[model samples]
Target: MKKAKITAYVDAALFDEIDALAARRRVPKTQIIEAALASFLSPDSAEQSEAAIVRRLDRLTRSLERLERDQEITTEALALFVRFWLTTTPPLPDDTYLAAKAKGKERYGGFVETLARRLGKGTTLMKELPLDLPGSTDPR
Candidate 1:
């Protein structure tokens, strides 16, 4: 195919980038410029670009939704635990308070160790529970 020559002015920085890209690809500067121009002038370029953006946005939306669901689960779990603890735990007498505190600290350490081991083993409560719980049909 025959090619025509044309001259146009561009920013020095832009020209430098083109030069670098052409050198890196081991292609002629004219080839790089021609490919760029072809891409820019293609009728479907905008549509293709928009479609790619929409795909990315869709993926991001799904990710955000998952994060939101996880947050809700975490909040619900915490709230339920707090409510249960408040209702079930009896206030300790003054004489036994210090002993209870010491025992609580020891229990907490054991809990941490158990949690670390569970996490290391990649075992999660979420994995144990069914996504569709019995007696619950609500979908969020």
Candidate 2:
């Protein structure tokens, strides 16, 4: 492989950490940088990009926390709306009936059937997920 040198500025603490990592791993900074770049560029090199991964994970954690807070606020608003609507509006068709008859029942039914089929596999996804209580031991 060809080698080239490039200079760039970085935060002191972060550069120190990077240098420490290189020293501990007994690898050069260039090797670490190259491997990182390769992982970022490669389709199947996830294990090699620890720094990028930590950065991405930190970003995702922050975004997810914001989203979770937003979700809680949205859920509170929705619950309040539901309470107000239940008291004020004429509630004939409830959500369950409305959902069943929304012409989307077929889509939901298909999803249910797909789950049943996957559960039939036994040793696949269902093995890793929580099982229904008492299990499906009935022969009926």
Candidate 3:
């Protein structure tokens, strides 16, 4: 191909970078400059960039949707469990309340220890449940 020569001023750092890229790509610095100019002048360059940005936005939207779904599930589960617990638990009689409070504290500490142990061992009830259970659909 016939090529026309042109002269332009460039910063020393940018020149060095172009020189490095040319060396890495096994091409002349002029070729590198020409390719860069071609890309910069091409009308499709902006469209290609916009397409990339759109793809990124789509990924972000999907991620946000998954996050929102997980949050909803957590909120519903917590509300239902709290409601069930409030309904099922009986109020302690005044005379035995102090002793019962102490026992409850001890049980809570034991529960925390057990929970920590299970978490440390990576054991969870969700993991034990079969994926093929009846009427179960993956939220994902």
Candidate 4:
């Protein structure tokens, strides 16, 4: 290899990064600078860069689809639970209504605390159940 020494001026921040990369990779700063310049100047890099971008976008699209599906599942579950609750809950008589309301409030506070603890612990019922279970129509 006929290597000739050349001097070039680089910004201090860029120089620091080059030095850091060289140190981390256990390579000379010249090699890092050469690799960077080669990547910058190569015609093939454009196509390669575009391919990399397309792959990333594909991954992001899949992630977004999964998010949408999850949201749909969550919305459906909440709606069904609310509907069932509304239909099943009987109206309380006026005499015991205040006591019932107090007890309901206490139970609700406990429910909220439990929910917060479960969320903080990252426990989710969705993850425990199989995908097929959610879509099943049969009661059995």
What are the lDDT figures for the candidates, one per model? 0.90, 0.74, 0.87, 0.87
Lowest lDDT block of 10, candidate 2: 124-133
TM-score leader:
3
lDDT of 1 at 84: 100
Model 2, C-alpha of 79: deviation from truth (Å): 29
Off by over 4 Å in 4: 1-38, 131-140
Give a tens-digit lDDT track for model 3, residues 1-140: 89898999999999999999999999999989988999999989899999999999999999998778767766887899999999999998999999999999999999999999999999864444335557776544
* Candidate 2 residue 128 C-alpha distance from true site, Å: 20
Which has the greatest lDDT?
1
TM-score for model 2? 0.32
Q: Please rank every candidate by TM-score, starting with the best.
A: 3, 1, 4, 2
User: Model 2 RMSD to the real structure?
Assistant: 17.5
The candidate with the higher TM-score, 1 or 4, is: 1
TM-score for each prediction?
Answer: 0.68, 0.32, 0.70, 0.65
Off by over 4 Å in 3: 1-5, 16-28, 43-45, 121-133, 137-140
Of models 2 and 3, which has the larger TM-score?
Answer: 3
lDDT of 2 by residue, 10-115 (tens): 8999789889999999999888877877878896665547778989999999989867866775688689999998899664566567765665678888988897
Q: Cα lDDT of model 2 overall? A: 0.74
Better of 2 and 4 by lDDT: 4
